[model samples]
Target chain A: MDSTPEFVRLWTSHQAEIRRYLFLVVPRARDAEEVLQDVSVRLWEKWDQYDPNRPFVPWAIRFAYLEALKWRQRQAREKLVFSDALLVQLDASYEEEVPFLEARRRALQGCLRKLGDNERRWLWLRYGGHGAVKAEAVESGKKLRKVYYALEKIRVLLLDCVAGTLKQEGWSDA
Target chain B: MLKKTSRLDVLLGRAAEEMLSPEEATELEEILTRDPEARKRYLQYLDLHAELEESFQLHAVAGGLGSVFFPGVSGWRLWTGAAACAACGMLFASVAWAYATPVIQKAQRRTIFTENFEDRLAHQPTGLPRAPGAWSGDDASVVGAENGVLPKTGNSMLRFLRSTHAEENTPKSAWCDIYRLVELSTPPALGSRLSLSASFAVAPASDGEQFDIYVGLNALDTYPVQAPDLDTARNLSNTTLGRRLPATRNGKWHELSVDTQVSPQTRYVLVHLAMLRRVPGPSPSHVQFAGHYVDDIKLDLLPSNALPVKTP
Candidate 1:
């Protein structure tokens, strides 16, 4: 049986987990995403060996961590943001923590909906707005610090809401 | 609220932006290495950071006018006009990042433009067939965010006030639409394709004629504004790709997206988002609009060989 369809189905469901796993090990967005691409190719080449009974992410994430370390090695002249010991330590335990991460991600949607006009505008300015936004902010007579502080406040609100929402939804361990 | 921000949280925030100093990075690793609780907080914050970025990615070019998000169509044009005096083409960096990727490397996907109806300052449609080409709609079309009307995403959304829009000085009630003018002087990639996606929300359900929503991506030889007057309906008819949204009575947002290959000779692309009243005969009601809403308009340019991302 050609597992192409099955591989595509399982890969679609678990790719985000792998992206998140790589994010923890590789701090740079472009580099982390690069490692993700490499890991994706590696996974597809090896999908014939994947066992349905075994958890997909935990099995797949090992490849992401390995490629991430290779990226780290290429930049070894500089001090590493995340040490190898930490990445290895994380690989062993990340599978247990994914549920809470996913729960938080779900809770964020509801929290975003709860934002007021000003709160939403601040998030849009800091995150969704374009690259020259800092200079634009200054030129428009709005303080960059004001936007940063406002963003920090909003993130706290979102994180708190996530925790509360999960608890209310009976995710006690979250 | 959490009492005082932790040292770990401060460090992680900087880390998300890739701004952490070498010393700060080492310290961050030490804390995560020693404390189990700290490690948990690190993962949660990093997860939050990534999720927030991804959500914004869906809304990357909300209110963007080929460059940055403009509060209103005119205000942004004025601001960019004045800003461009200092640095020409600096503002038009909407087409930034054109890295060469072979057809097979799909991970390098990037959003080229978006128009989430976040602009509240416009009373009439903003981009009405200009020499450069921009957004165009009816005098009745406006950004709505009042009377308990909620957008699918962002603070505001495009609301059709009436069932008719003026084209060539004649009011046409066949469909009410908002047009996004995409003028790409050069093809993004030789084999790349363009993806247009949008969300439409339902108003009151009707019995007489079913109202359908569609998003149109049409590649044109000349820019929309450069086209002679009486532009819209003529260009829309030459659509290269049209995607009809799924019919739903649930009163929720319906997402529709389409991908089309842009010919190398293509120069300008007109994106049409409309609510159509396809009844055999005209009725008294403004059925073309039928009170539906549009939001979260996004356009992405993907390499020709781009495919769904493979993962572990």
Candidate 2:
């Protein structure tokens, strides 16, 4: 009936996108969820600050990034020492691989849907605990690095499948 | 223009992606040194690369963990959202309208009571001799005495004296001793507020002197233990005393009394006295009133404990 409806619709529509953004930015799942709650509250409080003419994704991403960074700083302060430099390097790599990154993420969604029950369970097991590579390396008696490289290859295949799905969506450049 | 722009753009994109190895990082730096345009392009790509990386990371996260993070618009929470907004509005309006009238009135009354409160004494001599009996039918208030005049102290100032070796050349007068006219005027109850006021004067003595005065309800053991020093004690205001009484210099008048609560089982009362003096030299500026020099002190008592306590 009023601007409230439009605002609520806009916020609800982007909830998934914003949540996904939070997951990638915050390395820990629980911390990411906490930041998601904080970001949602801040968005509601400062909803008037949003410019309807602009893209919501980028606007929402900016707030999410700040919240995630604050969480990381809090973690760093509590723990006393952490390898922030490694995160910086990985972030840099992500930037360089943006074109392939988006394609891979899209392909991952389709790959998840297409996975058979066994394959889904394998995917879960791989990322479930310490991650597939760590879990397998322990059992296979293979070197940790070798197991990690094998997992990396598997990730690349899944990423290729995500890219293929994006191409089907007419995202040919992806 | 198109060809040149295309060449510059390709180089810029490569630098942006950090497709540069250690050797390439050095080469890019060298190119930045040689050509200002190339350096500008390199810096721009670096900036864009940082922005793009942050964006990609955010997007990837949002895509993967959207549902677990935000629980996409279920139901029932719709009412909660509306209620919160309405409550916020109500809270703001109520806060804006609130005014603290009772608290302000209480603070104002406290300030007035503290400022106007006083207990003072003035010296008005009977001009009578140092005798054992009342000053010749001088009718001033005393509980058991037949006449109002007080019995004079022997050769001393009749409980109060004027100094023979006067410092100010002021005329000597027979000073009277100020006594707290005591009776069971206070009710035997807790939390009873009472105020008593009386005035008296000190006569110049052979040795420069001061007076000490204290008021105690019931026995002298109760209340704030000992009296505060006389230097800080002030006489009651003219409004409180009901009259503008005569003044004294060497035979200066001073008024002193205390305002305190009446405790349970209060009966006997007494006024403790001590002579005060001002020590000379690099001494303390403390003005001590050792003896009493008061005449015809008036007492007014307020009954503040009239209300009986309701038992729970």
Candidate 3:
């Protein structure tokens, strides 16, 4: 197994895309993360099989897809999830949207800066920390229902702000 | 005025948090099937959710998250910062390799001289000078006949033709020598290695004709005044580097290369492209034609690093 610097760099650049691809197919985030870890070890073990002339993401994704199928088979008795056909369609859709997602992510920085202090604090509380909603509700002295509602409101505002910014930059749904 | 939260918004929010009940999941799926706008909004929200998760991990470690409500940001900042730095370093290293690798390869081995014969014609009109760099013997001619064997690269090449008498059972030989002299700005130091190579093709009209290559090097003063025979060629110059004899006479181009060390007294490099034949007794009942074609000659002075170190 070659763990050369070039191979490692190729793996690092595509790690996030591999994770998202696995997550889209797997039923649960925990299972997706486990598949991601397995895929990483398997890629390193089979690194010799990789052809450097080809693009790395599609090659790595082929391995990730196989690993995800294995994980799905192991969890077959669990709740129903996306079928293989649907997963393929979703994967294609996600790849098509990658450029748009990148633009959205960049626009997010400016939108984030425009958020009110209270809104930023809410985001940091819900996503910036590893705490349950109940814990967050208790800490903020708000009802659990109100905390969920506030978090939802914050997401809506950020989504609208991002859409507005994208439109200004010539982004269109079409 | 605050906008009322729609059912699609509630469903998407629960889906992002992975807390959607089975009934809500069914409802959301139905809505996505019925409405393209709902599906687009769902994808948008999901991407934003994932992006926020990534950003939190990135900024939380830098202490760039300016919120006190999120505890443990400092610890996350420390570990995340180190990982980001390592990743960036690897990325830069890969970029450096992508840009600098070709330059290094080109520098390590340079081309000292080359000839593709583009300037020469296989059959020139009378009174024109021969190709500037090439010198051919009296028996040799440039064969640019349209029906003859084609050159390996350009339109022309040096050619040598030999025909045999039908009844001369004794072994007979015929050959032609073509050479070019390459001048270097500085004489190579003793023991420096140089490579000489060329491409050749042969079409033997009969079974007895064969083609061969003989390479030679000499000082400028004693360079051959005329084409030398095989025996005289071996003894003529500062060095008779080597020879390559092909096994087959099928009109296909073959490359031959020889590596030799530079002598301290060497001033001129002469590359000889020779075609030789041996016809056995009782040759054909009719005259047979055998021709040789040559092109793309090169002599490279290999870098010192590429050469094997000489024993002291």
C-alpha lDDT of residue B307 in model 3: 27
Task: Tell me what TM-score chain A of model 3 achieves.
Answer: 0.81
Q: Native contacts retained by model 2, as a fraction? A: 0.00
- Per-residue CA lDDT of model 2 for B1-312, tens digit only, reads 012233344434444322335454445445544554553333333333333333323322212212222222112221222223332443332221211111111111111011111112112233211221122111122211111322222111223332221222324212222323133444434544345434444444556332233322222223222332211111110011111122222344344445544444544233222222212222232232333333333333334322221222
C-alpha TM-score for every candidate: 0.47, 0.28, 0.47
Task: List, residue by residue over B1-312, the lDDT tens digit for candidate 3.
Answer: 235678998887877777788777678767766565675676677777777777765554432433233333333333333344443443333332322221222314456777666655432221112222445432445656333567877676666543222222325334344555565657766656678878777663556544345454443323454544433333334454444343235566667667765665666666655555433432333223356676777788765444222222
For model 2, how does the per-residue alpha-carbon lDDT over A25-117 read when each residue is reduced to its tens digit?
A: 443345667888888887777777876523366587677766766677777654321134433433343333332333344346556566444
Error of 3 at B258 (Å): 48
Instruction: Name the regions of candidate 2 deviating beyond 4 angstroms.
Output: A1-7, A78-103, A109-121, A124-153, A160-174, B1-312
In order, the Cα lDDT scores of the candidates are 0.62, 0.37, 0.58
User: In candidate 3 chain B, what residue range of length 10 has the lowest lDDT sum?
Assistant: B123-132
Q: C-alpha displacement of A41 in model 3, angstroms?
A: 3.9
Indicate which candidate wins on DockQ: 1
lDDT of 2: 0.37
Docking class of 3: incorrect
| DockQ of all predictions against the true structure, Cα-based | 0.14, 0.01, 0.09
